[model samples]
Target: MLFFFFYLFFFKLSAQTNLKGKIYFDNEPKSNVTVYLNNTTTGTITNKNGEFNLEVKNGVYQLIISHIGFQTIKYNFDTSTYTKPLVFSLLEEEFVLDEVIINGKENNDEWEYSFSVFFREFIGTSEFSKFCTIQNPDVLFFEFDSENNILTAEAIEPLHIKNEALGYDIFYDLKHFSIEKKFTKYLGYSYFKELKGNKNKQKKWRKNRLKAYNGSQVHFYKSIIKNSSKKEGFVINQFVRKKNNDRPSQEELSKARKELSKSNVALNFSRKIDKPKNSIDSALVILKKAKLPKYIDYLYKSEIASSDIIHKENNQTYLQFDNNLRITYLREKEEKGYILRNPFSKPRKAFLQASNIIPLAEKFIIYPKGILANPLDVLYEEYWSYEKFAHSLPLDYEPNNDD
Candidate 1:
């Protein structure tokens, strides 16, 4: 029996399967880099020859490659073809810092033109973009005219537009309509925000204030240890633990008020964490890195949409925009009806369901119509032509995965 068990165990272990790969820099093997498999605990580091071996069961994996100076590379794992050893080549990013700083600037620029004009312009733009900017268009009208045998209509884009020229229209004749004046005005507004000195100061003050409040509250709880009154001290201790559990205790509320009166992280962290023991020091490190949640940003359903114009169309010209001038409106409308589906809602959610899930990386997918599957299938068509024109990164993409 012992001999048979040993044979079975060895067979199972060998069948577990091992993946091997080498990391190269400039065609020479490198070492000490971290290789991560996405959403899974499996990862490894390269040896002297830039080689790594990973044990994986049968499944797909996204192999993430990251190192000190190279831009990260992620590749999809294909279990069907395990014969060739995996090799990764990372490109040196000449302007990584520039890219990071410019991301928000570029993001805001996307609507600088359209938002400047009629906010309802996204009717010809992106549906997702329209959803974000406005709750509804000012007008949504479609009419058929027997006199000219034509469809006539107009609707504003659903974002708060600063100027008029920024928005566009796709007419039946394949002519693209964009207003120049409104777009320049919107760009001017962006420039105005960038030049404001007080804006940066205000942001810094708020950050410091939040940090100060968190630290002071933690400190106020520790103050109970010094109070000698047994009953009161016990009560305070209970309050401290309760605050950490359900809500902020009385002592924490008091400290929170104190923190609101000041705006200095350096001073508050120092005073609140006076006499740094090991535990306090570690706590301070965590507080420094923690970020406030989106809920704290006052996210509530807006009574109105943020789009440029809020117009409604009363005629049938809208269909003409969809069918004939699809290419002209391509750059202006990238994400038409593609939303991050809520995964917890039983439809098998995508990462984009929550507003907080920003795209950290992306890959382009190519496919013909009607082949890809759910959520992925819906977004594939949107990305086909406007991949380069839009500034944001794609969160999920699957080609030929549609049913």
Candidate 2:
């Protein structure tokens, strides 16, 4: 019996041979598809040119083929000594729901945070579509202030937008918002002090420079905005900075330095509207009704600042009763702040800010229009995913939901 077993082992070892093959889609080569012998836990991916080489034994086995957007396929084949080279034709699955139309062209393009409107300049585009759909009323608030010669602003409301898909809510308590052209110290480079350490190293670098002011920005938490399809509150803060590092001559810097030190520096606040809707219009009405700030440039240039919620407390206590015992719980939430310099404020001391807020709604509401309901159907379709089970597209891309 032991001799027979040894013979069988030798035969099996000699029978095993390498299986090589090329995978294609109808006559066209395909790449990145997984191919392997089924039920063996062994597989290999086709190279960039859709070529693959695998090893198999001299026996009948099942072949498996799979790709992200294609259906998995299986086929039975034998690895006999006389069998010729093998070839496979893979077919891609037609995901109709994943299809999108943008000006009659539907190509896969990853969504990014920046967008360009014509030749105006590249700017930060809203990531609302990236936020997961919320079934609750959540609001994100922000403010743009440029009253002082320093031209800094604060966020007076929440940083995360709750139920953002429904609408947006913002509260501004500032009056007379304006963007004024003034020379201000560039504090953004303050980090260099810690980074470089040596005081002389700091002096070797330009401490302050003049920038032709463009605009500013306040960071928004994309994650909070995503889960905020319901009852959510968040905040965003904005900041002002010189547009280009276009250094102002020493003389110009000296002249602006005097103006920067003024107390209660006389400045202007401008209210402008971009893509104004009923909600934004309503917010403007409130701003006007409150006699807050003067309206300056509409679709013009201005300086604005926004702050983020760095710390928060629920200020509430919850009690739970279990049989004869009671449990009370308290929690604390931590937030972070980010600073952004307006990339557009140069060669022109102009900027613009449009303010508005949308009211909350009940149930799963799609506001104004349901243009972005699919989440995957937005202008940038590459950043979204859909689950066969959920029947809804979410920004979350887990391996289980891939293709």
Model 2 lDDT per residue over 337-360, tens place: 001233432444322221121112
RMSD of each: 29.6, 25.9
Please report, in order, the local distance difference test score of every candidate based on alpha carbons: 0.32, 0.29
Write candidate 1's Cα lDDT for 47-141 as tens digits.
99899888865444456676645665657765556777888876674422234323423555532333333333222233323322332323222
Q: Which candidate is the best by lDDT?
A: 1
Query: In terms of TM-score, how similar is model 1 to the real structure?
Result: 0.25
State every prediction's TM-score relative to the real structure: 0.25, 0.21
